[model samples]
Target: MTQPNDGPPQGGFGAPQDPPPGGFGAPTPPPADPLGKQPPAASPIPPPPGGYGSPPTPPPPGGYGAPQAAPPGQPPQNPAYGYPQAPPPGQPPTQPGYGFPQGQQPPTQPGYGFPQAPPPGGPGMAPQQGYGYPTAPMQPQYPGPQQGGGKKFTTQMQIIVAAAVAVVLIVGGGIFYASSGSDEKGKQGEASSAGTGGEAKGGEGAGLDGGTEKAPADTKSKVGFQLPHPKVTDTTTVHGSWVTDKAYVKTGVYEIVGYDLAKGTKLWSVPLTGQLCAASRHMSKDYKTAIAFQDGKPSAEDKYPSCTQIGALDLATGKLMWSKSVTSAASGDEPIRFGEVTLSGTTVAAGGTSGGAAFNLANGAELWKPKADANNCYDMGYGGGDALAVVRKCGTYDNRQLTIQALNPSTGAPLSSYDMPPGVEYASIVSTKPLVVAADVGDTAGDGSSISDFFSIDAATGKLIVRISADADKYAGDCGSTEVEQCGSLAVGNNKLYVPTEEHDGGGEFGDTNEIVAFDLTTGKLVGGRADAGDDYTLTPLRMDGSNVIAYKQPPYDKGGQVVSIDGSTFEETVLMVNPDDEAIRDAETSFSFDYAEFIYEKGRLFISEKMVSEPRDPSNSLDDKQYLVVSFTTV
Candidate 1:
């Protein structure tokens, strides 16, 4: 998942793990603090009240933009910006915020559902035994010294799926999505159309519309503005962000706030009934997206409410557009809580452990509701945007069958379905148009990135094109284990898949670097073009800009980060926006984990934001570390 340092190995849904050493995007300590001095320690501040709508809570000492220090006698807790800080010796490891469980380490080889300790071998060593899955041996395109014996691994992950189902049944009949057919009757709500929610207040600025500001002839950028992190007592989640030509929109505690794109001044806010729980990564051409939130505010007894409300947000103009939810027959007609939401054309789709449902984007009308049947099949999740696709699970838990389907967005009908190979407990859709899917078949992707192979399929024919074996330890690409479309560090465009090689030794002393390589989707062969990240830097493909690949470069400890546009055919990079190397600005810029952070770059401006926030690691040694919600830079 593109960690910046050699931190703990990520396991399960808890804190993400670090990959093996010296590969693309490997974690290494940053250069010495640019401030050239330690921050003075301060007394801890009491946490704010519990529940939603609480005022912004400050973070622990030594936080970005604040005075930094560890308590006296406690070893310095300073860590590279954005990477999770490990607690001092003997103290419990730091816990990630937002409902992620603590203390579970990633399995040695890939295993779905439950996590077990790595089999006896040390890091980079292959697991001694397979967890009842078959193995397929293969070769790498650019072979190098890496973990495993160059043999691609897959596991019988269905066994763990069975375990999950049994646990759900035992735990008070929890939400277990098994659909044989469409049986649930959707409860129609009053039609709420786009822009129904009132417009947000605008700041004293002009050009409030879509499109980017003009770029400077010289691409070097300076600090545009920064938004302070909202003070949060608990580990709160601020999960969504978007940019319209006119404003920068972000999800706050119980509201969505829009700010002046270049000035960072508040322009508008759409307050919600509860905290935002899920957001779509893709935005429509009209700057519309989908989101999910709790129905009610959190109380003392029920601190975290179910994410049941689904809504479409208009980014150009601050509006809720429409908010609604559906009932699941499997859940006794209760509102089906969703874990993810996405937008495809005019369709808004939501899915979770209970099942999945779709709605009209213009008006919150039910398009379809999941149904129960003999086969016990359900739509696990979907990948949206250019096209609509779904990862459907069917059959018994012990012999669960996963299929990737290209669907008709308007009718929610499958246009084509490609059956996944066995032993894949979970699958993620990397792209819907090309219908590329990734899975840790046999749990062989030991790096915990949940990717071992990329299945390039013919969406129209529902036939396999090629299986690109991307050993997790060698490539930096990662896809969410459960979420259908959450993938990063790679991009698919121009009939090719572009992924970065693991970080390795660079030419200069004390320098490490990597490159982005392309693979032909049809033939599954290396395209022989590589875009190198110069010494002490790592390049990750962010997205496709026409035929060009826009990438972000995580710089060395002493340098500022950079955004570059690489020509697809030539593999040549053109500097788009280069952040300043000033000490203060550098710290602020680098304080984002490549994997977990949200990066938006357009028209010579780059914005970095966090998806999660929490209190200080050592609450007792709290300092007024100036934390920020977002840091922006521009070359205009």
Candidate 2:
């Protein structure tokens, strides 16, 4: 169930309000000219037949609009007001009529009275047949005066006859124009109605049959489908769950496998060989390529490695595009670690222990590497735009200072550099334009509570603009121990930031209620108020899609879960779709003590993968005989 924000009641789907007066289908007013401009001044001539001046008086006996009995031997006069006497009892009913004589059909051709087809290729040529009424006898034509000085005087009868003809044309054209406009408006109305049929109702999912009926069968069947898993040998284990729109799993000690999202179909797999340490994978936006970090082999007995390797793979074919080995100056026992891999325009970057490296995404050619300086310039990868961000630790562990730098993605040239305020440790880059940097600022209020602050810096000069404390009352709360990993638990959206809040006191369990607090990305100010996750459910902000936040609702162990949409502006909640209940899914959480299911949203669908326990479980590993079930819930 979803809750609608309190507001004024809206109109129901009963009878639609009538169109505004004088609009479509209203009594035909004086029609405009053929060019759709205003009508000209009233014509001096009398109106045409059935027009305003000639107000359709009852027809005389035996005339067009009146019925008449036939004489002793002749057939009854044709009922001119309706269909033409049913085509003399045997013939076809001559072009089905609607209260009009078949011969007097509505104007199909352009010209006046009882329209007839135009001549084959010529414009406006009169047809062979005239109006259905009797044709006047041909009259003699008189020659006009010769070009001499003698002027020819116009006759009064001639002027009157000409004016009458003009009136007929004007009135007839007016009627046609009005009728055409009416018909067009009717068609437009029908199209508008059909187009809005799938529009979402108040607080309900669109395309869900007015939000009353369940989603279609095809959508429901997408849930609980199996996803392809890599074969685990003695040296392999699942490294990551989702990479872009596909899944990546470790197939060998140094090999990774990629699978399609919908069906567990294997797409490609690649193996890494001869590296210093374990390899880590990163994917591109299109999922067509991936970058991995390969540590260099250390010298005999020397703990620090002098070289590091970066490898790129073509995900479509599982072939290595290229690999580059770079010189490293690290000389300590601590192993080098890698950060995020990001793609910016035509450049691909990977950040790691020594520093960061930029390479051409298409050819994997090394574009630039960090300089060998005491600053230890380590690349943090590219952010929102073409700006690449890096961090350098300046002081020792007790009083460390992080210097943040913004560089051009294409050339790795430094754009701006500034050291963060004292005592603030750089966590991760949240965005680029404002250079939002998340930092862990010491513990707050004892009780093992650590405070994380988000700083918005000017990207052009690296000047501190605003600082938003994530644990302050304005934000959600203190980032719990587990949530404060690489960066304070926060998700960045366009112009907004979402921070998770623990509704329960301790924040260690799955079923506890959790809410999300939003903040303005530029101003570091709270957006709206706190968005609660209902009574007993946990609401985890998964991702932001346009103006809506996609969140998941996890009910208690045995109950079902639902995917919900929250309006980013209003914080109104709408349940998009519900996931089916599986005892195995619940038991995996309660009994085997597995983490909650994982889900990814791509396009308009949510893909969820949950571990399912098999009947015969291995004692050594809980996941030994277990398989993962993949399911999808669409907007419908």
Candidate 3:
């Protein structure tokens, strides 16, 4: 999910520029050989059939003629081809020859028939020395060109040609090996980039952000380890949420941090150029990229009070991929706020006071913007998958009417629009397939108090299916209060709606008990009899763990909290581990407003974080001392 940047093209070796006009002007001549005469036009004798020097042949038989018998008192007579015999007493050894000498051995010299010294300073003549023999006197010069000299020159040339061929082969092999290695590295990079869709396909080492070490598998229980509280300052508010099944992300005013869920280790942290006003709301399927909105500096003249921008970042590396302004002319004194940042298929979208706009996920280039007439739309929220839900405000504030519209998430084109009943206002979206909406229709007593109603409508046709009244339904008593906003969070799973009842006063400092109510999505009827969790606990539905509904208790800071698992069909409750009775843990929980403590569920694991008071409270505090304690529990 790397967003393309508009810059110079990346990666490639420049093609060898066509050898300048006339091909490097003509190749230079080869250097002259310094050790011998130039080679002949052609070799006089053909190479041996076996190539190069032929294998050696057998030596003459009878040992080159039987050894001659020696005289009575003398050493055995030296025969031809025998080891050279030292001259009688004090004389030098005889020079060796290929065949027997005519009468007596030739004068002792360095070589048998070759010159023993360099020739006089002539034009092209020089003394010759046999291979491995030392220099000595010159030999008699021949009348014409020496036949042996030509053969020697030819032999040297053959050796030179073989050496040149070997050099070329070595250089060519090195280049080929280097190119093959580069190709393999490129293929691996491409494969990793392709897996950034909905499913990440490799083990821990697969998606490392930069060169960070891979985290070990998450096997330790919740009680085995605890993460230290994150650091924050008084001026900045810290928010935490899950970005992927194995990673959780935290955002502050100017920084975003990521952590490994299994080990609770900090993976990476990125600082932003502007103040981050919104936490990450949209993440690419592969969890490689995330979208966040930032509030830019206000205009100098204060004509345009608020400036906003949307940006994308690499999840693994914390690299800022791209950012662009998504602002329009202001119509009121209040600053603009972006309600939703989401991903629809391959498109990234952001909705604000001026309607919504969609951008290409690969480049961050705006693809489409909402129509001018749709400027009245606000409070945009994503409806599950690809449906963009918004509220269209019409008329004055006191006599205003709100209309709910489902738009194409990518194009911002309206698919269905329904005007809410006279006294009703949209509260939240419970489902997307059939478009279930929870609306707060005015109080039953007509005193402007709250009375909630659930509406399930067809998304394609805007046809109403069922309207369940909160006060009249059989399970109405299960809802602690008539106000829809105070009924806790709503979760839909296994074709049923799970809702947490508000904490009720039982003559205690804090509410003692609350129950979780389940209703069939299609029939609008209770799934089972009321199931009370117990005293001193409030259960809020978080997510589904296999076939069971997972919820957690939000106990008072002094009392500890625990995670619960309820059977989706039977509504039976099972208490997981309760928080340790540690004073530090209780103080951390009480440090922040109860709302700041967040519990997130993903891939059968529950993540919880509590803000920590690192230093003593001071109203004029300037030091950045805010922090949070994080931990995880396995639900499956």
Estimate the TM-score of every prediction: 0.69, 0.53, 0.54
Best by TM-score: 1
lDDT of 3 by residue, 459-542 (tens): 666655445433211111111111111222455555555555433322232233456676554555455443454544555665
Kindly give the stretch of ten consecutive residues in candidate 2 with the minimal lDDT sum.
193-202
Once superposed on the true structure, which residue ranges of model 2 sit more than 4 Å away at CA? 1-222, 227-237, 241-253, 274-285, 293-307, 329-340, 374-387, 397-399, 443-451, 472-489, 505-511, 588-598, 608-636
Write one digit per residue (lDDT tens) for candidate 1, span 404-451.
998998889999888987767678887776667888665545444567
What is residue 521's positional error in candidate 3, in angstroms?
2.5
CA lDDT, candidate 1, residue 537: 78
Output the lDDT of residue 344, model 3: 47
Comparing 1 and 3 by lDDT, which wins? 1
Candidate 3 Cα errors over 4 Å, as ranges: 1-235, 243-246, 280-282, 288-290, 295-307, 327-337, 374-381, 384-387, 396-399, 443-451, 471-488, 505-511, 556-559, 589-594, 602-605, 610-636
Q: How close is candidate 3 to the true structure, as a TM-score?
A: 0.54
Q: For residue 388, what is the lDDT in candidate 1? A: 86
Give me the overall lDDT of model 2.
Answer: 0.40
Q: Give the winner by lDDT.
A: 1
Rank the models by lDDT, top first: 1, 3, 2
